[model samples]
Target: MNPEKLAKLQSQVRTGGKGTPRRKVKKSVKPVVKEDPKIASTLKQLNVQPIPDVEAINMFKEDGKVIGFTAPRLSANIHANTFVVAGKAEEKSPEQALSDMLSRMGGGSLGPDSLSQLAKLTEGLQAGASGAGDVDDDIPDLVASEDVADSKTDLNAAD
Candidate 1:
């Protein structure tokens, strides 16, 4: 081997065969501000608590029947009494609706456990759609009584 090539090989072996030594870059970090003890003490004395999280109800209905219903897994805020339903749970089971209503009513504080019992109580409370229990059996049919008079009389008068 030539003397120059031997010196190059020896240098490469000493430096682990790297082309150039890499430089280490230092990262600049921003300093964090220290909290004032007086402010911290005042805040601690206030004893402010975070507001409880409330979940909204998402109801899905098909053909006037509830096909899907979702409730938040977390316990709701019982003191807050306003409930917002996405849509009418028209076809929902009465008990399920009532239970959801109660849960929404104040985060289930009023009667979360009363749903099944209330449902049982309201089972027979539905009114017949056809008015089958009405005492007036001779209720007039509005369509029959409607004055659907022909326009010929008005047309003759106009002529």
Candidate 2:
């Protein structure tokens, strides 16, 4: 082989020899998502209404001295506000948004009413289990063996 050709082939074989450096591929960056100004303005305009029935429940007491304190949960009546936002955002309904919020608050979508209903259901079940409930006097007796035989004969006739 020619000396010049051999040197050229050797250079090509050794990648790090710098024969025309490989081009680096540039990565595409995802664009930042901006929040809708209208939604922001609407949310800002709507004032957060505090829950009226919420009261401070005593959490911890050391020798009558309250040491630990649990903050009262604050809520807003965002019913109307939620509808406007949901409509503008083209997302879920206001009810769905409210249910999602309730679910996030550790209560299944049922909220406060669920606790009462659950308690009633539990009480009813307990009463039924204790045998204090009504007897099955109204329940009819099972069909006799003759009736079973008649039913089998009817099936054979259909075939």
Candidate 3:
């Protein structure tokens, strides 16, 4: 080959090592979602009243676990018999829960009426918990052979 042509071909091969460098792909922009104005207006039309002066909401589970919501936003609609409680719920330890209840009671004294109500609640809860495990006479314990055969026949007929 001629020296000039060889030099020109070598230079072209070196320059065209990889055909093209890839461009960095841009991240897609997320579209902002706005609430529908019509729905907003409809919600506004509902005569939902705000309930004030509620500091905390506590839910006591059957297993002694308590879900406490401090600084709750409480609201109610009397006509609809609906209540809305919005808050950041936090599970507290048993000690914390006891103290919270004590604090709510100011004097740490439950009156006779309150005590009776508490006793009733406990009794009811205990009864309900025990009742769940008991076998009732109404529910059959064993499946009859004839009933099983009948169900199998029905299934075979469908096929």
Query: Which candidate should be chosen as best, given lDDT against the real structure?
Result: 3
- Model 3 quality (TM-score): 0.40
Top model number, TM-score: 3
What's the TM-score of each model vs. the native? 0.26, 0.21, 0.40
Give a tens-digit lDDT track for model 2, residues 31-132: 997768985676567755545544232222212222221245444546654322121222333333333445556556674686575556556545555554
Candidate 3 ranges beyond 4 A from true positions: 1-46, 93-95, 107-159
* Candidate 1: tens digits of C-alpha lDDT, residues 1-159: 799999766665553335644334434689987757985575455553333343444353322233333433222223454232232223565446656666676566655457566665445334332244565769686674234455666667899
Clashing pairs in 1: 65-91, 78-106
Arrange candidates by TM-score, descending: 3, 1, 2
- For residue 142, model 1's alpha carbon misses the true position, in angstroms, by 11
Residue-by-residue lDDT tens digits, candidate 3, 27-137: 568999775797446546765666888878888775656789888977667787867677789987444665666658756676777667666765666676667567565
Regions of model 2 farther than 4 Å from truth: 1-23, 48-159
* Cα error of candidate 2 at position 28, Å: 0.6
Candidate 3 lDDT at 69 equals: 88
Residue 62 lDDT, candidate 3, scale 0-100: 55
